[model samples]
Target: MRTPVDDFQPGFAGRRSSVAGRNVTILFLSALTIMAGATISPALPAIEAYFADTPEAAILTRLVLTVPALFIAFCAPFAGLLADRYGRRKVAIVAILLYGVAGVSGVFADSLFTLLAGRALLGVAVAGVMTVATALVGDYFSGPARDRFMGQQAAFIGIGGIFFLTGGGLLAEFNWRAPFLVYAVAFALVPAILAFITDVHRPEALPKQEDRGLISGFFLTIPLAAVLLASVLNSLTFYLMPTQLPFHLKALGTNSPVLVGVAIGACTLASALFSFFYGHVRRRLDVSAVFALGFGFLAGGLALVAAAGSFAAILPASFLVGSGLGLIMPNLGSAAMAIAGEDNRGRVAGLLTASIFLGQFVSPLVSQPIAERTGYAAVFGLGAATLLMAALVALGLAGLRSRRQPA
Candidate 1:
């Protein structure tokens, strides 16, 4: 095999890439990235049962995904800085290869530790997809085109979630390891990204990257911490939804794979619809308000889920929760990227992605034990509280409203 340097160049790929091609790359690759997390959540209960002899196996199910998240959170800013200095496609391709291998590892692992190892590694790869993918949108695609892709990004997340959640359920019937193998599909997108994509314009001057001392200073800002917390809290809801809802629904007597799949599928559909509407809605409402409304729905939906004692109740609650998520996440991308600024866009988006990865990494762990100890209802309660807090934070930040028209 030729060395990586032999096949790719290090100079600017024009600092941006083609909108149509790049957006397709971002959407499909991100769908795969999001699928990695979603597919695993539904497989957890089965994996735990498969390894029932070790109680800890179930507790650390989050480890499979979260371990990688730790690396993503730590490495995201660095990925951004590299993208800024080097070029987007080069770094992205490397990260994706890592993602593919780590994801594929799940199919063949023998032990719980081995499985966690795969997930952890996959998390690192995912960090690249998350960090660089978002930055790429800003790097290549712009204005309506960028916004549409971002909306589609959110939509694909829902679509991918449906594909994986039910598919995960189906795979669990065969073997717990089978669902994770699905992540290997990411490799196919590599060729598309490599072939069709060309540079687009990078945003006008971004913030100068911070040095080691300034990086420390950067973390100290109240706004920075708030954004990070907001990101964490946000993922806590989005990631935990798939992880926790299945258990809650199962407890309520809707244990059929078909219904469970439908429930997960319905959320994705709702999310798709919300994503479609966000552009117009976002135009009328400020980013912060849109965020708050989305989160407010999250709090309400979780509230309903917490009280639900029967499977019939889950559908409406799922739609509401998914709707809130759909409304908030895409717009959050635009708003947060704006805050991160141009030069440091990569770093800030990287950090934000990291925060999200960490939150997603930890989210299932946050609720699984709570559900195990207290009950599924408690898990929903915790989700509601976190989402409620997110709403308040967004509402407080309403003052940061931009004069620029909606993206």
Candidate 2:
């Protein structure tokens, strides 16, 4: 966007650029992005049971988990604008503080509606933290450095997802309220952020030659549109495990939260492992090829899930899906960064974040009806079909682009 100028900048030096300090802070905060929806996933069945007497309890209980995603989709773009106008550090600090407060408030809510309200507030908090955290990555690093850093960050989030989902399952074994305690961890991040993280540029100032037109131009490009479309479909299918797997496990004759958590957590673990090596994968493959590989794995995994008869089968299926996500997540993020310059990084990151969560929010809506009619297994079949189509589309597009390029 800055007229193709050199990517590096003369950033803040001294303690502000201490790699270890800032990386630790950002990695810790990145975990919060997963917390918005996944932390409560292990307890979904229990929550539904608690409110069983209420009208439409099944749907509303699922809403309790996904409602935050809906709010995040709506609020993140505005949050990005705020971070751009205000300092990123300031917005992030406030957001983290609110995240803890709203996240923990779920423990004391007397009814489903009260908890829904708290979840909605948690979404607003997540929008700010997520947008600012990703924008900071762009602000702090560039080129191959940025690619490696994004992969590392994706690994952290995947690992965090594993921890939170498994811990939530164990906590739900005692009571539904117990998992809310994990939200308190956000409070500990505040001081660390204040001491370590610093803004890369002055608030509201654009780098030279980084015209507003270029920002708009980048957003309208075909590559960005393809990345976002793939991201949306990928998220919608990936989320099926988290949002509906518990119910599926229940239908399979096991109601133990630990087993359900382990089933879903397997995907996260695989994703983390793949993300840790994403840099190596990226060195050999272009973005579209990576996407094609990812979707192919996703398709195969979903097919396995659709036919799965036991937890053992689901475990391997989850791993395959996770592997695909590992390939897709970091590449999509870095692709966004490649298109955006510093001036619009926050806004672009916000839009990307919004697309991801919006798919999550819609996952249940799309799956619920099919699940209600045919059963949960049908949902996986649908996901498999969707992902297979996506893979074909990606590969075809890649072939076309390759042919069009000058040799």
Candidate 3:
């Protein structure tokens, strides 16, 4: 069997010398997934007001923020297949170029439908970027290195969210379209990608006679399925903050875009801090233990959001939510990458990406009606209850796994 070391071509020693550059490049690439939604979240209210005359303006405005996720959910599997068949580098570069074009097109949109169309194309770009970026992480690192890198990757994304969300909020003060300009940053990363990333080769896949479907090959595994489920749930719950929090804050009589940015940035800040420590935490706890811990934090945070009477109360709740997500994000990536083999890393990465984004797309669909009927507090309370149940399940599973282990 070819080791990760042998998967690289010649001149790898020179590449190894610049590992920091390579890691930074990929880390920024990973941040693009978070940026896809976050950079525009602060502008959501502004966009809604701007297009108030449009039918279903409220739902359609939220869709502007989440439509990319729907596209990512659909296109990521195909992106993974392409990466596996051709190369990560080629697909990533093309995606980055497309990301800049589609993302910026929102600034020129005259109608809600035009903006949604651009956002859908942006989603296609993100599917490729997110899939290949993750596959590259798996390709480039293994074992403890992979764990540490996953933690750092999550941290970087959180940090990026701080800047993007805060900046978007500030920019929205000028014009709803101002936030769309941030997507232009994607173009700057193309040069870094070219400088630091190299494609890793894998052995040819199994014969046609032996091959099962890609989804069946990985999804059928209990551990992988559990990880993907966790990802989906985690994303669904985390996204509630972005998709609903602004409206929640507005309902509480605090509607400033900057304050909205700060509130969400507080969550990202906590996520970054906790994510920085994930590798250390992973050393002591198994993935199940981490999941239990993360879900516990999420439950507490959402419960706090449910109970909060003022905008100030939401800040600490945001921190708690961020803390839980910080741990869960890296854990999901590490666990999924550990389960995937070299040959199918791209496909596994793609599916994982799909699950994560799918939950984002579904968040508003699930929470909006609940919020509309019972109010935002009830929606948050329901999320807290659901997460609490998930935490208990994780703890139970952890105990069962421990008892099954040979002494």
Query: How far out, in Å, is residue 335 in model 1?
Result: 0.9
Give one digit per residue, the lDDT tens place, for model 3 in 67-129: 899999999988988887778889999999999999999999999999999999999999999
* Model 1: CA > 4 A from native: 1-19, 142-145, 199-225, 396-407
How many clashing residue pairs are found in candidate 1?
10
Pitting candidate 1 against candidate 2, the one with the higher lDDT is 2
Candidate No. with top lDDT:
3
TM-score of 2: 0.94
What tens-digit string does per-residue lDDT give for candidate 1 at 1-407? 43212233334432345434555777887786667666766666676677778667756665665567777777787777676556677777888888889888888888888888877777667777787778766654455555666777888778777888778778766777787778777778878878755434233232444323215545335665666777778787776666677667777777655567677777777887898677677767777788789999889888888888787788888898889988877886766654654455567777778888778767777777777889988878878987898788787767555534475
- Go through the candidates in order and give the C-alpha RMSD of each one to the true structure: 5.9, 2.8, 1.9
Question: What are the runs in model 2 whose C-alpha is more than 4 Å off?
Answer: 1-17, 207-218
Task: List TM-score per model, in order.
Answer: 0.85, 0.94, 0.96
Better of 2 and 3 by lDDT: 3
Candidate 3 versus the native: TM-score? 0.96
- Among all windows of 10 consecutive residues in model 1, the one with the lowest summed lDDT is 1-10
Each candidate's lDDT (Cα)?
0.72, 0.85, 0.90
Candidate ranking under lDDT, highest first, comes to 3, 2, 1
Better of 1 and 3 by TM-score: 3
Stretch of 10 with least lDDT, candidate 2: 1-10
